[model samples]
Target chain A: MSSRPGVATRARPSAVPVAPARGRRRKRSYVRLVLLLPAFVSLAFVTIYPLGFTVYASLTDWNLFNFGAPVRFVGFRNWIELWRDQNFLIAFKNTAVFVLIATPLTYLVGLMVAVALDTATVGKRFFRVLFWLPLMLSSVLVTVVIGRMMFDPFVGPVDSVLDRLGVPQVLWLANPRTAMMTIIILQVWWGTAYTIMLLVAALESLPPELNEAARVDGAGEWRAFWEITFPLLLPVSSAVFLIQIVDAWKVFDIINVLTGGGPGTATQSISLLVFQQGVQGGNISYASAMAWMLTVTIAVVAGTVYWLSRRWTD
Target chain B: MRRSKGAWFFTYGVLTAWSLLLLFPMYWVVTTSFKTRPAISGGATFVPWVDFDPSLQAWRELFSESTDRWLPFFANSLIISVVTAALASVFGMMGGYALARWRRLGPFASAQFGFLLLGQRMFPAALLALPMLIMFQDLKLLDTRVGLILLYTAFSTPFAVWLLTEFIRSVPVEIEESAMLDGSSRLGVIFRITLPLVLPGLIGVFVLVLAGAWNEYFFALVLTFSESVTVPIFLANQINQTESVGWYFVSAIGILSSFPLIIAALVLQRFIQRGLVAGAVK
Candidate 1:
């Protein structure tokens, strides 16, 4: 735990400095920049350069495999064709639906679990670790498990359970109608742990006396939460919500492993489709175009959420 | 105050049920690892425990030349994660301490750190796969463990630095100054004084880095082809290969791959949580 300054002298103060210290700091900022140049360079390569390269790639016919042959520069043909592609359209639609359905559901469940655990008089610590267990397991493992148990046509556990209940033993994942839904369900399971951790942290940070006073005022549990707890929670929830929105944009591994965008591209996420084109199918330029478009769409969608949340919070 | 005992039972029952649901996949993994191929391949009955007795056959298959892909794959992951953890932590601490007290909480510095934090978390990680591979190859770091480590360090360090930096700032400055005034150099002050104080923060950063490296598939998929494959790649291949999908082998690797981190998390839950909340407003 951090060393705190208690009630007295409580505000986190900055380093006080003499004139010499101020001059030294101004000097040091530039010095730190020079010193930290390598880290900055590394970050640029990781974050920025790839962006530039991909953007350039999207505009041209640059296939490395055809190294012997000269590279051709196709204009915005790739982007135009990508927009026209039916599969790409399905992909965009699928990702939007998945995000729309998954986020609120995960938020509700994740918040309930986090808040309940945080306020619990017993097993709070134990439950925190228990809840986070899913997060520790790699998505690769989770996807494999999902691919077997949920997406499998026959002997999938979902169908097995449904069969016993006398419901139709429909293969929800294999069928186009239910494939996206199944993926969405799996996605929720994968992400709930993170939401639980963050929400629990925020809930725990709520001043205890607020709840105590709310109870004293004859406020029921639900009323107190709505009136006091929820309002207090909105900021952190805003942050978490923005983070999840960004996360939804980039999710690739689970979809790649689980469905492979099968059953006539019913469940192909934008990322999955992009990967399929660029890597597997070897349509590098077209894939780059798709990726560029998807990235822009994500930026617009998630960026709006981020901006709205920031505005709401401020 | 007497509520229904039945309702209390029901609440706990539901909680326990949910907890069991959370744990069953993991448990199923462990159990399936012990089942025979026949039992696993799903013939008459799917009960791993009931049909066939325990066997190390799957493990043998995993280690043998036929499935020897995993041997190198696991080793690659181990190297990458361990190296990433070590470098990211050391560099992170240095960077963190600098950020914490280097200059005043000037707007630009704070903005820089904030932007770093947001940018790292926000941008889709997998999108960098193609471009990063090209960059790494151009730099001759492609398909090299060192290349992957550098890339991993690039991504993981920002979060580590931010969190650790926040933790560093939270430390009473007088502690470092006191040590420094006593003929302790800046490095000495950091090593002898600052590090011990931020041990919990360091632990959290390491755990996070390890988790990132372990779970990272995109880079491991793209940057690494032959020699530098990780567990995720290995697992994916196992899934792809039609040579009898051994659930237990996958599960065993899954359990084995994640067990070290999970155990570390359990033991250091207090330390990690404490470190994680280091930057929360007082």
Candidate 2:
């Protein structure tokens, strides 16, 4: 994970000399501020300002339907309604299930593929490119191609091959349980590419001496991997896990295109529901409340994982 | 480190199986685009001529007949992605350079400022969708490509700044300091010395931002309506109208829109890996 030693080591504060004159130091600081101005201005306008606006909007009874009507401060009414709403509860459960399942699944599968690629002697580059190909694709494309086309019930290859093999048809996206499964499968499919890329790089960077020493000490391949390689990989593995957890919580594009949260909201994610209420349903205040809830949930979950991983690593 | 023949066999076998599973959807998309409606609805056909008759019907429909529906969206995506990438790279480079060379900016240290920028990404885009819609509505910037370009630039700049900072930090300060000592202005040192050294990192930032904007769906779905619909939004809209539109056509559009990124990813695999690792591991 460290950069090339000497190159990245040069930027420490102690490496640069202190400015001799106070006036010149002040002027230099101003120049540095000028350099950061564009990024600060743009991010403030889009991210920071909108964040504040969402907080304020969540407290008010603002509906796009009531055009020109004066907005009223509802004072926790929307937050109160969120817990009582069944749709919101279902979406929350779905998102929780998604993050819980998809994060670990992606990490494990990515590790397996990364190990496979690292162990293989032939066609390593070809397989790397093939496995990394899905990460290049947009989620919408992945859903349309894989979720819709490949998993289509009647004419899909899965069903066709199943029929040929004399097995009953499994509803990939129609039945409730199977619908969630399909979304998870799609997520894992698209997500593991990132995990593989990171882990492969991590694996390649590990010194061969540890595994070689283990092998010489009469360890089998699996034993060597478990005792030597896997422990060494924990840092990168934790990083990948945290990233996947955050991404899995924001699951939207696939569900939107694949099921549209159909099968009776069985696969509705938090973001999808927020979009449904805030944008499509025009209950901006309520949706904003739900969005803030999602934000808080993500922060808590990510913070917990980060804390746990740090403890485990230490 | 030597492996037994059986171990090598197992490794190759596992990799081969996983590769096929990964390749099947891509294969299906490419073949499905060539299939006709009857050919598609009849059953899964793997071959071109034997299982089904290959045709240009989907391609013709997309490119020739429904040109108005997809082309404008395609153009919008191109303009928005390129402009966003360019703006983000420039802003990110400047921000990154400031963080790299300077120790402080007013009350905050450079590292704290960088972390503040990265914190912007933690909030979900869904959280911003409603407020941005209303904000854009008030500003009369709704449903415009320019609005999307600015928003995407903001969304992409944090990672770009973080990544490019690492890249810029790797450039030894002595080079720039020596250039300044040689009577070159600070701006001249940056342009003539620092810029050339960090050019690869700059391109990495540009490509990453371009791909991120190109693949973005939620913001485009929320911010734009008709004229500024990007490629992913257009494809999603097609999915909504599935009754009239065929999967063949959608598959074609998927292949066409995603082809560029796939090629770029393969071509710039090294730079992309560096950028990704820098973002994740650091």
Candidate 3:
């Protein structure tokens, strides 16, 4: 019941009569620290400790094959080797391409669907639920259902329909270019649901009066959307865009399940390579270096997007 | 605002087309679950009665004695996901409440703490997978349900903490203060007053975390092999191990594994939507 705004005064009205204010504040501070300790401890043990270990491992020559060989500090040899490694280089390029193409494409499709949902007068609730369904699905299920079943080049429905239309069957997951396209398509299909969810929420939260005013001023629907609604949505849209970029950068499960990063490493994301080098091939130090590289890349990309978004939104 | 007939037509057209495109896979998976191997391998059949006759051969095969291990995997997923969600939710609630009520803890402000928790999400799981594998090996916790439960809980708690902090902040502080004035302890006030008020948010956190853990694949694949395989790992193994196993069986297992969460999502749609947007929009 403190009168000051935004400040939490721990001066308990009942306790203030008996205990000294300073002592009460100290006790309350202890309580707060105790409450916060579990979360911090768990996160540190799981995230911070592992991150530190990864950093250490990345600098050393640690391999499971050389068991009990006594790990030695290599002074950035692993990092340098990663630079020259063709597989790692390919993975870096593929991950970058996947993020660049998928992020913007997801935003565009999400925006289109969000606009459609927002403007529709009939069955709004039904459509919202239907579109949001994909977001509820796991990546494995999406890959199986969408990638393997529906897009099966041999007997899948997509090829069947194309055949009926007299169009030659397209190799969805066999060819390198088409394989990448299939991955992107699966990403857009699954990722757009989340984008739609965020965008729809943003669109609905917008003040209707601005668009109403624009319409009354004889601006067409598209103009009103672009001039009034779109600007207003910049903040949320930019946030969603940044999130999609970070998420796309972490793309692993779909690729692992759908094509196993196949078509000869054409769809190999950094995560896939990290798994291959570290877990499968027992090259711990090299994979740790790659993992750290992926981490730094995501951090930089996220920071850039956040900085650019602030400028645009402001 | 009113629109012309043409505009309405265009809007509905887009909606209809997108809906079909979005729903086709789901429809295909469901129908494929009902078809025989011949129907699936011969060609794509859009309808059951029109193009091919439907059978429960795949469904029967999934539950039959030959595939006896499917139940254990399903149970493992269920147990691991539920335990992780519950653990994360409880820990996150306590942490979130501490963050909401206090301005600072030691040298860091509550907002900074919240941001630190959220920053955990940005670290790629692949970065942590190797260390966790080595750590779990040392602890002799590899390929066990307890190992997965621990990892999933730690990974999910940050999200829960961030989202629940927002939910906790929405609750007015006056209610708790009044209860404390009436000779109730802080813990009592939290349990009796705040917990009930934030029930919806709690449920939202639980459902979201549960679904995530249920669907988790990367960590499970890295950590588990035989005794503690989850549905995703099992499904992937089924596909990768043999080319002879029919697509219909894979589809049946996929449908079986995915249905529980889909139903939960539909039932708790309102809370889930609110939870989803709470972090993103603000």
Candidate 4:
């Protein structure tokens, strides 16, 4: 019986031991490279190649209709001219203010809603549905829906209600002061759902026992939230903030549909400016140059956010 | 633990307020869509609530009021969304399967995929104008539904692959191994064993990809010409129409256009939430 067992084990070992020999190993490696090659090349030709082409085009005065006509290498002039361009300057300012307002506001609203949803005893599912619904909406559609009513000046319901209730009807998307303000409103409206998702995800992952411990310590509801729930929500809050900052930097459909950078170009964002220059005015190279600049800036900001997330989480 | 007094009120108050604001845009679009031409532009009282002197004035215009081929374009949008979702899920499933099973090549490929995905759509839509225009023109695909689908798939595939890859990776290899032991082929194991488990993820990614396809405008606008216009292009066409088809019909179109996406969002919101949490955590 012992001899039979040894023979059986040896037979199995001999069959299995040298199946994937050195030649098979090489072929397998080659196959893996083949499988992964498309993803890498797609990233290259589709993604990286365009980026490189845009950079080269920026250095030349490449007109829209004449990609073949751009032989003149007009060096830093596009960059310099865009720097002095008043529209670009205004767009940059508006973009900065937008990032400042929307990022924190989104995080705040998201955290508040997430906290509220977590603490709710009834209709939890419904609340989650309502809260997460907006994040799924297309920006173009949302902007189109709200543009007219929300921006209505005279006899607009907002004005009518405010007048009846003893408040001024501020021209929301029209007035330059409140143009940015209204943009912030649109942002917070859309961004809150994203924030809520992350915050809720984080809150759920957290140990409920910590919140319970705080409650047992006789911490008031607000104090328990401030001490326990709030701190843990920070990582998620930062993540949402980073995403909004990157996204808001590219704010387009809202600015396009709502204002058309109207009332003397008050609400022009970086992206809207690029669209106008590239498409409307046919200043292709300048727009591409400016766009490349904006892209690098955003990449840096996004990189910082990622580094911070890793710094804390790790 | 002692539950605090008035907490429910606070929660309810906050939730209700946010919901109203969230719902405000949808309400505004719906109400505005019902208004008459002059009522929309003649005065600032644009809310369609009282103006429910309800007319099919706008809807009629959207469907047949154009010699410029309206119905065909709407059909184009529908076809594109459906095709993009279907193809993206199928190919994305294959790609994701390969990725999930091959993670031993690199864990970083698996670990920080979210960050890579974050930058995936970073390229501005207009930036693709020159290159895609060149490529599609060469392939004789310019102004074709096939061209747009190709572009949509290109834009959305990275995210779909990343999401589905994670979903697939979470499926234990032992399941496949057991099926293989039972004399199943690789294709059979995938169809009979792997797909059923990740079905929710597949649907979730489909919804996400389809929603993105429906929303894309810049590329669709640039890549497509006369015969291939989507709803967004149809709406953008009205931009140059001076006198008649004022913002009222625009609002109507806006509401109508949003209907499919909103319903999709509402219906799949729950499944997507589950998919995200499960795929993300695992």
- By TM-score: ranked, best first: 3, 2, 1, 4
lDDT of 1 by residue, A229-312 (tens): 998888878767766776786768877777677777887788887667676665677778887786777778767876787787
Clashing pairs in 1: none
Candidate whose DockQ is highest: 3
Sorting all predicted structures by DockQ, with the top scorer first, yields: 3, 2, 1, 4
Candidate 4 lDDT tens digits, A1-102: 012334444545566644435445566556656654445544665677778777877888877666567467899889888879888898888888888888
Itemize residue pairs with steric clashes in candidate 3: none
What would the per-residue lDDT of candidate 2 be over residues B1-282, giving only the tens digit for each residue? 678777787788879878988988888989999999999888789899999999999999988889987888899999999999999999998889999887777798888988887777678889988988998899888999999998888888877888899889999999888878889987999899899988888888899899999999998998888878899998888867737458898889899999999999889888887888778887
Candidate 4's C-alpha runs over 4 A off are A1-38, A65-70, A75-77, A154-156, A166-171, A308-314, B34-52, B55-70, B104-118, B126-130, B133-142, B236-241, B244-248, B275-282
Which one is best on TM-score? 3
Positional deviation of residue A151's Cα in model 4 after best superposition, in angstroms: 2.3
lDDT of 2 by residue, A1-314 (tens): 11243443354455443433434556776878788888788788867898899899999999999989999998999999999999999999999998888889888888988998998877998998888888788999888777887888877898888888998988888899989988899999999999999999999999878888998999998888998999899999988988898888888999999998989889999999999989999999999999999999989988998999899989
- How does the DockQ of candidate 1 come out? 0.42
Q: For all candidates, state DockQ relative to the true structure.
A: 0.42, 0.73, 0.75, 0.40
- How good is model 2 by TM-score? 0.94
- TM-score, candidate 4, chain B alone: 0.83
Clashing pairs for predicted structure model 2, backbone only: none
Docking model 2 quality class: medium
With candidate 2 superimposed using the best TM-score fit, by how many Å does residue A151's alpha carbon deviate from the native?
Answer: 0.9
Candidate 1 residue runs with Cα over 4 Å from true position? A1-31, A72-75, A149-156, A281-283, A310-314, B1-14, B43-56, B59-69, B104-107, B274-282
Q: State in Å the error of residue B246, model 4.
A: 4.9
